[model samples]
Structures are given as structure tokens and as C-alpha cells.
Target: MFLAWNEITRSKLRYALIISVMFLISYLVFFLTGLAYGLAQDNRTAVDKWQADGIVLSDESNTNINMSMIPLKSLDDVTAKEKAALGQTAAVIQLDKKGAEKVNASFFGINKDEFLMPDIVEGRAFDTDDETVVNNSLKEENGFKLGDTIKLAGNEKKLKIVGFTENAKFNVAPVLYVSINTFQEIRFEKVDTTENARINAVVVRAKEGAMKNVDLAGNDLKSYGIQTFINKLPGYNAQVLTFGFMIGFLIVIAAIVIGIFIYVLTMQKATIFGIMKAQGISGKYISISVIVQTFVLAVLGISLGLLGTVGTSFVLPTAVPFQSNWLFFLAIGGAMLVIAVLGALFSVRTIVKIDPLKAIG
Candidate 1:
């Protein structure tokens, strides 16, 4: 530690440049991670809030909740501790009578009396067919508020926003929640009846063992665990994989860059290493100092980068999806530290190979 500190203090500029590079890389990694996580969460935040064990969708829908159609009668065939019918559709809403600004949104039909109903963050849940509860983004980003009437692009039936819910997004769009009956009317353009009523899926809370036994084959439906269902959402898996590959490649690049930096620095100090060895210093001690210096640099760089990421999140535009997971940050930082130490170790070979007699001459 003493040797490492003394060397760093003697050559502050040389080490500062390395730390700056590390800081930028770490910042990018953290920022991209937050964006990836946020976009993914936007795709399924509403579903995650269900905290259910599994979901039942029509077999032909290919695990896509948006494409699935299950007759209301099929609900009876699903065996679970509890279950609720869910209806889904995509629509456009007009913020004003002039229709100058329209926004795409996902419509979720849920029974307020059922477990799928989200807790309202502001105002109260809908009480009438014309009243609706919507994601808070509309209020925060689109100037929507309680008592504001939301007009559908082509439909004459206007919905009045009665409440706002946080973290209620689906497929990256804000969700507008309505009663199952109202949803049936908006989507089907007709009142639900005994023979024609249908829902997209059945969300259930059941034990893992029970989920295995709850078969819907007779009803022409298939069940999936919650995570499996989330993975099947349109574009969800693809986006996650794309970001994963990018972040992974960045990590590798970081390791390579740090290794190269250490290698070059070690080569430059080869004579110094030899002289130290001639003075009776052990190669092991010098190698340990190199590792300690790398660790110190990584810690400082990662800390600054994390702080910058957090600061950026606060000033980012509302449209940019971003979410922070400290645990994820910690994991990434820890991995970087280990990789950096390994990189330093790789450069230590140069120090070990330094000849005391040649260095002194």
C-alpha cells in the first residue's frame, strides 16, 4: 500500500488520465443499465404489480397476452387460489377537443373488485363506466389530471380520469384502466353478454405445485409462470438481449483497456522495478503494489461514475426511460473491481521478469 500510494503521488497526472478513462466507461455502463432496466420495467410494470404466480392465455395467441382471447366461461376451468380476467387493447387518446395532440396508450380491463386492481396513488378508483384510472405519466408528462376527460380518437364515449396510478405502464406506453364491462364496450363496441363475453387472459395466484397441475388444455388455453409470461411480451426479450450484449461487450472492453494501460505503465517502469529488486525488494511486493494501485483506481473511477449516473437521471427528460437498482450497480462495480485486479495481475509478469543486474547497469 505504501509503495502504491507513493508511486501514485509521484505521478499523479499519469494515473489521473487512467482514472478518467475508467470513469467514463463506468458511467456509460451504469447509464445504459438504468435505461435497459427502465425500458424493461415499462414493458411489464403493470403485470409485475399483479405479483401473481401464473397467467392463462389462449393457446393460439403464442403466449402473447395482447393477442390472446379466452371466453369468459374458460375462467371456470382454471383451478387456482384466486384468479381475475384481464382484457387488453391498444388505442389513441386525444388530450383536447382540437385533437392536436394524441398519445398511444394501452387499455387494461380489470374488475376493481378483483385482486388485479392496482392501488390508486391519487384520487379514487373508478365508480362509473365513464370514469377511468390512468398511469401517472399522463399527469406528469401529458398534463392530465383528475376530472380531465380523455377522448378516444374514433370513439364517441369519453372517459373521465378519476385517479392516477404509479408504475402502471404496458409495452412502454401508459395504461388506462377501466372496468371489464367498460373495456368490453370500448374494445368490442358492444355490451358484454353471456355468449359473446371474452377476456385476454386469466391472472392467478397459486402455489408453484398448483400451477403445474392447473391445466387448461380442455379450454383450449395454456398457462405460463409469471416470468415466462413477461418474457413473451412483444419485443421484451429482444430488447433485453440487445442491451445485455452491449453491456457485456462494454465490460470486456473495459477490462482490455485497463489491462493495456497497466501493461504500458509497467513496461515504462521496468528499470525502476529492476532497481527495486537490486535493492533487495521482492518481486512479490512490487506485484502486490501494482494490484493495490489498480484496485484504488477502479474504486475511485466507479464511485465518480456512479455519482454522475445518478445525477444525470434526475435531469433526464421524462420521455427517457430510466430506473436505478443499487444492487445491480453494486454487482457491476464489484465485477469491474475483480476484472481490474486480474488485469493488473496480468501486467505483473513484466515486473517479475525484470533483471536486477540489467536494471542497475
Candidate 2:
């Protein structure tokens, strides 16, 4: 280990370069992983908050929530089963002060008293027919305040922003909570008359002992012209899988790069190793030195990489999706350790092959 440290210290420039490369690669992997997680979370944030066991959509609409529509009658039919909170949800377009046409916003219309309403960060949940709640992030972005009015979908009547909530987003859009009647009014364009337009989907909460067979009941819902209840909200599994694959690939690539660099470095020192072997130094000592070098590089590179990730996260814009779950960081750390060990092992083969007699001659 001392000899290995001396060699690294002597070749400061080479070691620095290799460590820099490793640091960059690790940082890239960590940053990309965060981005992927943030994107998927933003895409499904609204649905996740519902905490519903199942969602009912139109059978003809396939899995696309935007195309799915369930009339009030259909929602009633499904809710009649038990433990279902039938509500309306959709994405609506509104404009910010910049007049940028079409800022997507999630519209959730439920009974004010439903348990699914997100916890409020400021103000309160909407109780009156005309009042609505908007996410604090969205409210801050648009410079909205309590009692402010915002038009929805070019509707002549503007909805009052009565409250602000935290961490509510849908399909990457900030969320707004309104009365089911108001949601139906804005979406269907009829406040006084029922024009046959209903909710896009119905959120259902299953009761205990109400049959644990969600798949069977979901299939049954299809018979009513309503799409089967999506057991898990759409896109969640796919999004997670996609991100997982990306992060996995990145880690593999980083490992490969580090292994190749370490192998080449070890090969360059083969003659020196042979000389050391001839001087009564055991092969075990040489091998241990190589392992020590690997550990040192791995620790230094990973520490720098983590620092870079943290610094980048701090300066990243809010619009840019980035999140760090500590579990993910720990998992990445474990993976890095395993890969670094594997990389070090690659140098062992070269060390074992050193010919003491040939080098001494």
C-alpha cells in the first residue's frame, strides 16, 4: 500500500487525469438519474396523490386519460359498488402573464370533503362553487395571490384562486383543485344544464372485504363502455422502467471506462512490478498495492462526483426536473463500490503474469 501510494504521488499528473475522468462519468450518471426520476414524478404527481386503488376510464379511449370520458351516470354506476370516490379530472390550458399560449394545468374536481384533496401549503381548499385551489409553485410562477381570478380554457368566467397547495402536479403541469360542479362547468361549458359531458375518469377507493379482485372488476367495467379500471395509473410502470434502464446503462458504462483505464495503467507498470518481484518482494504485496490504488481512486473520484451533483442540484432551475432520493444515492454508492472493486480486480491478472527473471536480465 505504501509503494502504491508512492507511485500515485510520483505520477500526480496521470493519476489526476484518470481521477478527473472517473469523477465526470460518475457525476453524469448521478445527474441523469435525478433528471429521469424528476420527470417521471412530475408526469404522475397528480394521480399519485389520489391514493385511489383504481381509476375508471372510457373503454374506447384506450389507456390515454385525455381521451377517456365517463359521464356522471357511469361514475355513479361505478361508485355504487363501494369505497369509490367518483370525481372528474382533466388537463386544461391557461395563459401566464407572458401570454404564452397554452400552459397545461391539471384540473381536479371532487367533493370538497373528499380525502383525496392534497394537503394545503397556504390558504385553504376550495369550498364554494366559484373558488379553486392552485399549487403554490404555479401560483408563484404566475404571480397569483389569494382572491386572484384566472380564466380557464378561454372561458368567460374566471375561477377565483382561493388557496395554494404544495407538490401538486399532473402530466408535468401544476394542479388546481375545484368543486366537481365547477370542473364540470368549465370542461363541459354548462353550469346550469347537464349537456352529457362528464368526468374524464373516476377515482375509486376500495373498501375492506369488498373483494380484492381489482383485475376482474376492472375487466367488468369495460363491459359498461367504460374502459377497464386501470389497476395502476397509466404510464407509471413504464416511466419507472425507462428511467431504471437508463441509470443502469450509465453505471455499466462508467464501470467499463474505469476498468479499462485501470487495466491500462496496471499494464504500463508491468516491468516495474517484475523488478519489484525480483528484489524479494512477494507478488502478494504487488497485488495488494494495485488494489490499494484502485480503492484510493474510487474513493476520491466518487467523493468529487457526489459534490458536483450536489452543487449542480442547488443551481439547477426549477423548470428543469431534478430530484434526489437518498435511497437512490445510497444505491448508487453501493453500485459504485462494487464496480470499483471489479475494476481493481482487472489489474490483478496483469500483476500475476509479471516475469521476474526476464525483467531482471
lDDT of each: 0.89, 0.72
Error of 2 at 262 (Å): 1.4
Candidate that would win on TM-score: 1
- The clash count of every prediction, one per candidate, is 0, 4
- lDDT for model 2: 0.72
TM-score of each: 0.97, 0.85
- Residue 269 of model 1 has an lDDT of 85
The C-alpha stretches of model 1 lying farther than 4 A from their native spots are 208-210, 213-217
Residue 52: error of model 1 in Å? 0.7
What TM-score quantifies how close candidate 2 is to the native fold?
0.85
User: After best superposition, candidate 1 residue 148: deviation in angstroms?
Assistant: 0.4
Please tell me which predicted candidate would have the highest lDDT against the true structure: 1
lDDT by residue for model 2 (307-332), tens: 89989999987778798876887789
Q: Give the TM-score of candidate 1.
A: 0.97
